[model samples]
Target chain A: MNTQTIPPLAPDAPVVLEMTNISKSFGAVTALVDVSIRLRQGEVLALVGDNGAGKSTLIKILSGFHQPDTGTIVSQGKEVRFASPRDARAHGIETVYQDLALIGDLSVFHNMFLGREYHKRVLGLNLLDNRKMREQAQLYLDTLGISIPSVNSTVDLLSGGQRQCIAVARSIYSSPKILVLDEPLAALGVRESAHVLGLIQNLRQQRQVSVILIVHNYNQIFEVCDRINFLHSGEIALDASTADTSEEELIRIVKSGLGRKAIDAAAAQVRPGPA
Target chain B: MPPTAIQPTKKNAVGVKVPRTMREQLLILLSRYREASIAVVAIVLVIYFQLGSDGGFLSPSFMSVVLRDTGRLGLIATAEVMLMITGEIDLSLSAIFSIAPYIMALLSVTYGVPLAVGAVIGVLIGILVGAINGIVTVRFKVPSLITTVGTLFFLQGIVVSIYNSQPIVAPVEQPFNAIFGQSLYQPTDALLSWHGVTAFTPFLWALLVVLVLALVLNRTTFGLHTIATGSNIIGAREIGVRTDRMKIYNFMIAGGCAAFAGIINTAQFTSADPQAGSPFLTLQAIAAAVIGGTSLLGGSGTVIGALIGAFVVASLNNGLVMIGAQATVSDIYLGAAIIAAMILSIQVDRLRTRRRV
Candidate 1:
């Protein structure tokens, strides 16, 4: 895999979100154990793992879909608790699930303004300001450099890449401080994946939006992500900056189920840095 | 880019720009609007009936009958359109319709309650039943079809047992009938009088209801949320849409509309029948909604389309009679028309999809 070289975040960049020793379980099955991750401001952190590696569990916890059995989450400088997805959203955390959460029968603008619709009172009745929404949706898409036929076009007609981009754009439009994306490109072709990657890169440049991207492809991680966190057996086995890691090492670590100690040794060999 | 800058343009093979012909343009427009296709069907039926009946179908008296039929069916179908868009169906709406008018007549004649007040109470009962259906289906996670079917039989039984399979005549001196269902005007000579085009009060009420609902569905946030709920319940809930409330509200609206339709029926005939709301009436409402391009599967529909669908169904019944067809033959033709309309709509949907590609 070809790794693209991008500027690394400053070492002194403040952490915007921190999850410490998070653990969760379902009935008798342990989905996550002592998992922790940190997100820096304006950084794209790729969370990579095989299927059933507890990546979804961790993401759901952060997005307020599931509660961690043990742990605390700190946003900015203060500890916070999310009781529901809406609560998490209110605290500036937005998640775009794999399904995109888009109503396929609705138009693009309608999907963009799904939950937060604009309204104008006419004859004492609050009617949807469709014209305003259409204009704003078009403006937002254009500003993000996303292209589609029309805002009025129904979402189902769009390609997978377009849909994924729309989902991301919607999250960004809400101006969330941290955006969590779950397997956004899992169903896209090579070209479509490239389209989404380009969108992520563009978003990083355009705003101070922090991202937690859950993906399976190493190439995608190297292409747009600033850092990588590898989950193995419900724990984060590897956490390193992309600048100090190689695809061969990542592949080896992922394939062998190497624990955090081995990854620390490997990371140390590549770069002697404070543990 | 500005919203208007992104006009939909067609590209053919090799990515060359292709200007569409007038016929193709019209077809594309028709495909975009679900109501347009049904509107075309209604118009064609009208012209055919006018010619087949040697202009007699266009007579004011005959037109009055068609309008009245359309109005009653349209009211029920409008309610169905709202409920269906939320991925719910109210089979009990017919039962509500049957019982509401009986309750009104019972209160007005038996208890000597004010006619207007009794009518309002009757409609409220319909709303209450609808809320119950909504609550049971949503809270218990019961399939709406099963819940509504249960209510349907339960309410029907109540109507039959209470009224004892008898009919009650509405008070002839009640002036509320004039506003609800009495004819406003009739053409004296029947020479295409526009003033008497829509003489039936029920037709007028249907027209008013359809226009208001069309506005609500197309222009209101609640309508959009309703569409979202029907389109994807999980997605809607994720966005904090309170989808259960939306479903309940739609049910209430369905019940209210159905009850109003029953009241109109009572007003028009000046009587309330214990066996008024039959399964056939429920089927006709569903049929009207479907023929007007509303999907039974939900997520997409138009109120205007439902009204036009009712018109098509009513016109076929009226025209078939005017042409001297037997009742059984007319039933066959109506069934065939429903199937044909469904097929045509599906084809149009395919055409739209292909054109987009």
Candidate 2:
């Protein structure tokens, strides 16, 4: 249920990546069908949908966890397909997963540098260069007007919001051109959700960065994102700018069955989440 | 409380907090104090035995045997503790230990090589065995319990199979045999008469292992990784630790140490018996680790504690044997002790975690 819908996006927001005619199926289930959306650099595009709306499937395909059966993914005007998340990473695309997928026992620095560790050796390999990793981890956090005082404290000690922030920091640390977030604020309290939305807003300030956030929180979508796309039953039913749309339209699009009556009924009864 | 106060308590959510009685708390604490309590028990037994005899248990001769016998076991225990910390069990270490000296014997006696060169090669062979075990465990991602158990059987089979494959046993030379089997000094009457045993270099070897392993576990990054990996794989992975590398390396280290132990055993005897290292597999290594305070469940433990645990187990064996107890009886008691140690550690860890809240 959405009470306040977003308006249309401004013309200045440049599209950085686009997936056209995307279709995906698992055996015979057909989880996604003919879905497409464009993401713009220095702009936030919030993917709004209900449960079983094929949001997960769509993002998984983009993140390289799943491959779309038929689609042309054009990134910065060049078509591409990723065989794995690691492959996507090489092309400057990163995802901050919902679970945070961080090493809970590892220090903040180690978690950020997970997999993509920096090392110095006698001739470019060998030695772990732990001192340099720690110094650089501090520098990365400092750039965001945040500081993890100790690079040594395990990630488990941080609160839920801080952990999400840390995951975002880690994704941005590699300076990826496209960032995808999956339901980041779902489990967070009101204050934590606000902080995360603020961080997203700050991220939008970076000119070369583009973000696609998959969230059920439409209020959060309106607060932070410039445009919105709605997925229903494996298809994009509504694609509109936040500046021009209303939550009633989004709810109607969501609850509208195969008839006019359901759409009218849904439009009449739209009530957003909490106070 | 004010609305904005941090802990906004809900009346329905609060449960009755019952404080445990003094007797219950004492029982809990006693259970928590594992190796130390066991050590105390060992001390009590020693005191009792000493008082029962013409104070022989209190005599330097008896204490020396305890220390020297406990030393070999202590080395194996340290190695076992290190592996346990990394959440992998190298049940084959016992077999590796027994097979090592045989390798040395073959090199020294069959090839007619110098003892020093044979010994160095033997050490390398031991390291190789450990590394291979590490590789296999990491590659397959199999439960180490099953993998190492298989290796234990395999290594033991190999030890027996190739024990005399080269048909070799080095002749016991003066200093070579003395370093392994004899004490540096003994209280003896004038004539250099026979009928005496002394503390061996194997004892010193055990002590050195304890000191070195304790420092490595407490101070090194490798040690930290071992703890991290065992704590939670996801937690360790999120931070980007190659837990796989840590475990395999740990298994290798354990294997290498066991091989070195085998060499010590063979040098001490100055002869390689195909089946000599057999009993050592579980009885000594596991007992030592348990006594040293290493948790088989992994994550937490200390090397010094394991050393102490080793001594306790060794002393238990020596004491029971002295009192004419059978080998089977010793095994039963050893099993009981290890089980008790494990249970106590678990309960204590839970208590501490709960107290943190």
Each model's lDDT: 0.83, 0.68
Interface RMSD, in order shown: 5.6, 8.9
Report residue B325 deviation for candidate 2 (angstroms): 5.8
Clashing pairs in 1: none
Which segments of model 1 are wrong by more than 4 Å? Answer: A1-6, A10-12, A20-30, A66-72, A77-83, A187-195, A198-206, A258-275, B1-27, B172-174, B183-199
Tens-digit lDDT string for candidate 2 (B177-271):
66555543355522233324334467777777777776556444566567778766654543445788888787777777777776666765566
- Cα-based TM-score, every candidate: 0.88, 0.71
Candidate 1 residue-wise lDDT, A1-275, digit = tens: 56667776777878899999999999999989999888888899999888898998898889887889999999998999988788889899998987678888899999999878999999999999999999999999888767776788788777666788788788778888888999988877676577778777766766777889999888788888888888887988778888777777788778866676776666556552213
Relative to the real complex, the DockQ score for model 2 comes to: 0.17
Superposition error at B313 for model 1 (Å): 1.2
Q: Pick by lDDT: which candidate is best?
A: 1
Q: What TM-score does each model's chain B reach against the true chain B?
A: 0.89, 0.82
